[model samples]
Target chain A: MWRKLLTRNEFYVALVVVGLCLVIGAVNPVFFTVGNLFDLVRNSVVMGIFSLGVLIVIISGGIDISFAAVAAFAMFVTAKILVPFHFQGTILVPFALSALIGTLLGLINAVLISQFRLPTMIVTLGTMSAFRGFMLAFIGAMEITNLPPAMIAFSRSFLVTIKQGRFTYGLHVSILILIVLAVLVWFILNKTMLGRGIYALGGDRSAAERAGFNIRRIQLFIYCFVGFLAGIGGIVHSALVRTARPFDLVGTEMSVIAAVVLGGARITGGKGSVVGTMLGVVLVVIMNTSLILLGVSSFWQRAVLGLLIIIGTGIPAYQATRRRRAA
Target chain B: MKQIAWRAILPKDTNVRWLLVITVLVFVSMSLLRPTMFFTLDNFSSMAFQFPEFGLLAMAIMLTLLSGGIDLSIVGVANLSGILAALVLTRLLPAEASALQVVLYSLLALATSLVTGLTCGLINGLLIAVVGITPILATLGTMELFTGIAIVITKGAAVFGFPELITFMGNGSLWIFPVPFLIFVVAAAVFAIILNKTAFGAKLQLLGTNPVAARFSGLNNTKLLLQTYMLSGFLAALSGIVVLARTNSAKADYGSSYTLQAVLIAVLGGVNPAGGFGRVGGLVLAILTLQFLSSGFSMLRFSNFFKEFIWGAVLLVVMVINYLTNTRRERREALLQAKECEVNAQAD
Candidate 1:
């Protein structure tokens, strides 16, 4: 029964998450409190969105270290356009602009990789630096702190609430957005022909081409999708914090990739799920919060996250080895 | 007539020729942009010194790429080893040690760093080769693992105050060239030999060309994989020692930028990501070109942002060119084979 349970990917991920949460809750009851849980979910939402974008690329058998740079670029562009035009009152304007910029950047990545037949890793690596340079040049290390109060309130508003005398819990707007995206992505990945084609291409490019799939178009779409997700994530992150700092997301891509890979996505592609990614995001957020609540050394937290990434990927890797041996 | 056609169209080993052309073009452009400074020995010497640290990293990246793998943990290994060397030399060494003693200590530091790299490489190799994790994912995990350990050990602090001999290795000049530059030449020569002359080198090339075929032919895939990673780790560690010696300080994040930069160097050098076709001579030229470009930007007083922009733009352009050239060659070969097949069929 145990072996059978371990074979199901989602089952194993769910079990591990629940087990960790329970252990943490047991150690510190505060970890289970309504207020704490809500805060945890809210904090995880923006990062979750970014991870979702990375998941698209990973699923397509590519990797993008440029996501964080693109996110920072979007945030800078949003701030520059909104602040200069005095359109900060209209949250939709900056949000849409950021998303547009992100999509455009993604399209550039797609064109270079697909059209030029360049390696995805090298192309994105170059863009990461390029985008970061653009951001630094545009912003000049400026911080946009004077966001409209309405925008702040909208960002901070609770979308769902439950009250108990002297205690309350609620889901933030960010969490709502994350749930909506998760659902949409799940639908697209599982129910669409394009999604299946993506899997086919990632599985084996030559075979997919032989089967009459347009490899170039699918790759372009994948990169653009990741860019769009990153844009949305950047806007949401800036809104939640009520300020735009151009350097806010440095080193964030590492964490996002770790979460996605840990959740059971194969880096070589053709294997991943939105549901699995969601759980992976939750696991990482919980680990961070639990470490803080337990008063573990801040230094050790990074170490723990690193260890989790290794072990998480190692599990499936080990399983694959065993299966190959048995065969 | 055939020889002329081959010279114009094929240019036997065009990759090497192209690399040389690019290097010369970059140098000429730099000289034009900064006429007085670009050709000066002082400027060249400084540039030479600054480049070997990155050169070492490029070498590490080249080895792993040749073996049909990638090592994301190189920068992290470099950071860990360099920081450890800094800490020991500053905190543990006696102040009155002779020059020879200091040199001995530096060598010891390098050996320790190589060992650290070996261990990390072993873990990465075992995961990818034996455990069946893909190269990128396995190294990505180890990248985090090794870097995290570095952070934990140092708590995000920088270490400094190495012995003068160690510092001299990084900063001192021997005649007209920097000590580090000399070390780089020696290391590169040794590596070039190991990669081109040895049986192990041939096996690595075979592994990169076709792992399954190599395995079917009775090659010990696992052992070769392990050795390749070990070599990468050793070089990374050596880079760390050089880095520590040069800067006179060791920070936990010393080599963070190298992770992607090394990949860029390798790819720009014509090392195919799919593996099995590259040469050290091309890689060496590519590294010099990149270093000159960056150094020229600084000499021209370009802003940090502009320098970064130029680096990215150059990297992208070079990569696109390399990709197009390879694809064209592949198509030409395929067409030739098709014509050969058609001729045979008609005869039959």
Candidate 2:
């Protein structure tokens, strides 16, 4: 029976994760409320954006532990650029600068990994620290708090509302951005030759090379795309909070990677979906919110989350082994 | 004489030799930048004392890599176990216990820490070997799990005020060298013996090099994996104890930085991430180089961010060089094989 369940790619695990979320929500009535639900969605949007970038890297058979650092750097640059040019017509400068810095950082990672043929894990590990250091040196020990009211208003503006005061919850602009990006990613992954090329390279690089895929170009593009997404996320995050702090997103890579893996992407690379990844982000957000509602200790929340990840990933592992044995 | 000269010109392994030369150059440059401050005996002692904790972690990482796996939970395990030890020695043990009783208590703490590490390792091995999760994902999950447990246990506080004997290992030195430093040296020697001179070591290398081949040859890959992770856990726990003793406190977040540092050392020491090849001596040299650089940076009063940056940069450079050299050698061999085939075809 277990072997039968294991044969399908990630079907059982997905069902289990959804089932667990429902069970937790049932235990706490507040978890199912509109306000809490919207909060969960908001949380997912924040992590999902970053996880989407991580998903691209993992699908390409490379890992980037430096995404958080890139985001932090983006935040710093955006804040610095925006604060000085607070003149009536200059918000675009910070936006462009942040995105550009993120792309450049991503390009550096791409060059080091693809051109040098270096290990992704080690290279990103290095840049993670280097980028963070650059941010610290540039920003000093100060936090940027003078965000433009325009940016804040844009972030908070409701894109859609399901009304009746107590039951009313609205979609923020950030969620719309997340959805748009997710759709774009889905299209690229499924429609374009470059998208197919990424999967091919990840599945088996030599085979992909033999089939005429430009491996270096694909890798470079993926890293840059990841960096771009992280940059956008950074800008959105700072705008939402209305402040940019240097140490704001420390140790955030773990959650983003966790979300991507939970979405059924292999850490070893070549398999993942944007829809599944979005679901993963939602699952984590739901779990955290529900746990809080259930009055569980905040610290125990971390352990529980960790256990969920282990069990979530462990089921697929067990199924794979069982299949290998049967074969 | 001619063979020696040729060997000097073409070192047995260019990457390893290059790393050695680079390490020496870094040390020299650091010494030159702040000659008096960097070379002082007091600074040397302080640096030497702090080296053992990270050094042991590096060794633990090397062992795991040799077994063809990586353990991301080492940092979490070390922190958890160190905190446990501090709690036991300071709060749990009877105040008026005799010397033998105190020794027994310490032994118990050590055993408990080791067992904690073993259990975590068991979970990792079972997930990877039996359950079939990849090492990266399995360890990543456990890294969160273990660290979370530490936080839950301590509520993010540090455990302080251990007995004198326990603190002595961290603070007290034998003549000029710290006791923790001695412990590191002893641990390194023992690990070297286990890795290089034992039958178990041979099997580990075989398993790392080619799992399918090793299994077909009748090696118990599963059991070997379990043992390797368990050993890694034990060493990490030990390092935690040393760190706790040295600092006179055990924080739930201690050794948070060692996770990447250990991997950095393992790779720099010439351990192949793909597994199957590495040397203990290289790891030792890598640890020394890192420690030397870190101490130098601290002496120069570099900010925490810059220190971390330099550490990461050095790791990147070392790994890049290692990867390039290995790939270049493989390409050369492939070319040679192709040439030989072409010549044989001509003759045919």
Candidate 3:
């Protein structure tokens, strides 16, 4: 049992995450504080949500760089459409509306990929530009500071608050959304027939088709689901940040993809886990935000993260090779 | 008879033929729309100056795609190379330096950028070819790594203070053609020759077509991959020099949008993203076509965002058309083979 566990990629990744945490905690005990933990949880919300959507795509033998643009379009357009109505209602309304927009956009990708048989990366690249351009050109490029009341109120709402001296750090309600979505994604990926279809397709598309899986339907579902999640992530991001910007989330594809890959998700597809992905998200978020506690400058943070991703991926790969040689 | 003549006039490659059609359509429409502004030599000259950096980037990406790999790091490598070259120029050249010293230092700066690009490519090659990481992931990591190094070097600031000689290369004209355009033409010719005539290009394509087959054939897959990535780096570095010369400055974040745009141009040029097929002629035609469209759009007073939207629409439309044509061709070939087999069976 121990040997079996030792060979698993997730074990090593989890170990690395914990090792990184202990190192940071040792360097600065303040990293162990409740407020810091709360802040970390809050920071992970948007990125974690993005990672979930990306993880699904990666597991299905494809990559989607357009999620960032899709999220931006959904979030920005939702904000723009809401601006004139002044319809101040529950946060659910905007969330639902954004999700609807995202699903429609994602459907475009699904149709192009499934029906036309275009390459996923190329299609997403085109769509990424199209969506971003549409948002900036037709929708609007201005940052909307005047968000609906529910969004502003939701930003202030917290599931948990910790008072630390003069400052109080509250775990935002967005974290709850992330947790619920993560669990839902885990269930979808593990407990559903559609999930099995996704795995089979990723493992080998021809074999999956031979096995009677509807490749087109599964692809449609996967992309649309991703779009839906991206919409949720977008709305959550705007609510948490208290503003919507057309350019927001455009450059986050690389880090999110890296985090997903680092989480034991194979870029070649057919392997990944939600728990592992969450751990990867924590590792990436720490590498991004908490390096200051270790006295590393902000400019150097990206370098460190890059090195960590390379090392993180390299170790597991080396082990797999060695194991294969032994076998 | 008409179809045969049509085929005779057009290139044998479907992608080249399609690109030619698009080029003619864009040129004629733009010329007709803005007869004075679009048809002028000056407009064409200015576009020639503007497109080389972007064209070089597209070629850099096209090379990687031909090897069945993608280099997301080209933009990062370009920026890093430019920043390094910019640093060499600013730090080494003494104030009020002689014109001779200026020319010499500029050459040194160009060399530095090339070297930086080579080293960056070597790192990417090692990670991908040796470490067994996916090309996308390896390049993505190196993209950040190279860009991070640039950021650390510049502290997220643009590097300036290039001497006049280099700036002149960016902005100057030789005869009727811009200097950058000349450089682009020369580079394109060399790439065309190397890809069409050389053993390396043949092996690289074979490697891309099937890595396992290449390995079984006793080809050094690792060496070919390394060379391919290194060449990509070399091209990216050359593009960096062009950018530095043209803009007279270098920054860590310059041309962040070029990464995606380069992929678009490369794919539109008939470079298969899955690997093992592309042409220099197609890529040049793609670049020219896009440039004309961009210049025309600007002349029409359309917003920059609309250009992006149009590019996306064009890419999707081209992809759909290509897909239909490919399927039709495949079906026809299959049918012909079936008919031949039936005839043989009747004879038997």
Candidate 4:
């Protein structure tokens, strides 16, 4: 089991992530602080959830660049409706509603892709624009700067707290929920027939179909799950900022995709794992946070992420080609 | 029969006829909807002035698309190229501008634009062709890299105030047409001739249609792809130069929305996403159609948000329809082939 784990790309990624964290801590002792470490995990929750969606779709041999849009759409819809009422309640209402709304939108994408047999990338690209535009046009295109106190309070509250030697570090409620969600997703991907079917579908569509894998259902599930997760991402984003802006997290899809891809997720499909994607998400979050700690502008994040994606994809691709040539 | 007849004059799959119909319908509807602002020469002339920025970009994207790959980096290349030219214009030029100096500086700026574009394109070509990186991912990476370079140079600020000569290239008109529009026309014509009249274009068509077949046929697929991407990069640079001239400012984020818009225009022009089908004439018409719709919306005081929605809807709807019809046609052909094979076996 250890040998197999070592052979896997996720294991390596996890090591790199940890190594980088240690190095960052070494460089700046503040980076290793419990408070800082927890903040990093909290910051990653949204993208981590979003990457889970990306990982599934990629595993199923399809790509959706519109999750950010989906998240925004669901979040905006939920936020716009809830921000008006100062209801004293759990923020689950917005979260659940957002997930449902996101799933429906994802279903539309799924239907279009599966029914028409259209390419997922192009279709999602179109939806990405359309959904964002829809949100931009919502309510005279204004950003919802004022979120309800319940939502705001929910966003700020940490679910778990750890105190050790004069330092108190708290994991955000969203992060705890996300970790649980990640476990559920991990169970689905690794321990379910659907998971095996996804691998089959990505490996060879016709063979997978012949083997009795329901391609349509799998595709539907993937898109919907992605959308649902994106919805969660939207809420997390809004909660983090304590506001539900219409156009928040615009163009963040690339970064999320980058993280997933960096985590050994092949764009060609049929290969990737939840653990790998989680590691990728953590790495991205740490890198971004550490860049700030390093006194570099956050703007470098996009460029650096771009480089990582190219190197990530390029190295794997080059190795594959070399293997083919050798064979 | 009509398809064949039209195919003689246009590419077999050119959606120009339907596009023409749609364009006319939009024009007429906009005219009816907003009579005061829709049809004025002034409005159109202004649209023409800004038309080439995205239009040239669309054309650049079309080249890569035609070669069976998409260049998501066109906007990035354009911005980078523009940034280089802007640097030259601002830093290299003397404070006092003599006529000779103006001409020299303009030439130098144009050279910088082309060279910068070529260099970026060269890297893209290397990544996709030599390294075998998928076009989308390669261009995506290059897009970020190029844009990053521009941001680093400019520090995320706009570089402004070009010479008057460059502005004339951007907005000046010959007779009644805007200069940028005229440049677009010339560019479209050149692309049309190159695509239709050149051996390289034929090779590109074959490459896009089937890479393995082309490789078997002893075609240099890598070189063809490299050249195509490089041309796209060059075209992007040209666009960047025009934008820099017209806007009198250059920034890394200029035309950030263009990557999607250019893809929209190219696809809308009936450039198949799978490649091997497109025409410059059709592309020009597509650009005009979109520009009109965009301007029409603005003229009617409609928000630009609708334009984005429309672009997306149009892309999705058009693609779905194309896929359905193409699949049906393929099935029919397959059926006919099966029957012919069976007949031949029986006769033998």
Scored by lDDT, the top model is: 3
For residues B1-348, write the lDDT of model 1, one tens digit per residue: 887986875325677678778889989999999989988888899888888888988988988888888888898888887877776777667788887878887777767777887887788888878888778777877787787788888898988888777888899988888999999999999998998899899999999999999999899999999999888888888888889888888887776777777887887787877777778887888889888888887888867777666667777887777678889999999999999999999999
List the candidate numbers ranked by lDDT, top first.
3, 4, 1, 2
- The digit string of per-residue lDDT tens for model 4 on A1-327 reads 999988889888888898988887777898987788788888888898898988889888888998998888888888788767765577778788888988999998999888888878888989988888777764436678777677888866877888988877788878777888889888998999999998898889999999999898888888888888888888878878887777787788777887888898877788998888988998878877787777677778657766866786787677776786689
Candidates arranged by DockQ, highest first: 3, 2, 1, 4
Residue A179 alpha-carbon offset, candidate 4, angstroms: 1.5
Interface RMSD of 2: 1.6
Show pairs that collide, candidate 1: none
Specify the CAPRI tier of model 1.
Answer: medium
Looking at candidate 4 chain B, the ten consecutive residues that score lowest on lDDT are B10-19
Cα misplacement distance, residue B331 of candidate 4 (Å) = 5.9
Question: Per-model C-alpha lDDT, please?
Answer: 0.83, 0.82, 0.91, 0.85
| DockQ score for model 1 | 0.63
Worst 10 residues of 3 chain B by lDDT: B125-134
lDDT-wise, the better of 1 and 4 is: 4
lDDT by residue for model 2 (A1-327), tens: 888766544565477667866876777877767677677777777688899889888998889999888988887787776678673444455566777888999998999988988878878988887788767854664888877666766666777878866567776768888888898898999999999998998899999999999999999999988888888888877877778877887687887898888888888889998877877777777667677676787878778878878988998778788999999
TM-score of 4: 0.93
Model 4's interface RMSD: 1.8
Stretches of candidate 2 above 4 Å error?
A: A1-18, A90-93, A138-141, A160-170, B2-12, B323-348
lDDT of 3 by residue, A1-327 (tens): 999998777888789888988999999999999988888998899899999999999999999999999999999999988978896888889999999999999999999999998999999999988888877878788899999999999999988787779998887788889989999999999999999998888899999999999999999998998899999999999988899988889899999999999999999889998988998999899999889999888999778877887887877766665675579
- Interface root mean square deviation per prediction: 1.6, 1.6, 1.2, 1.8
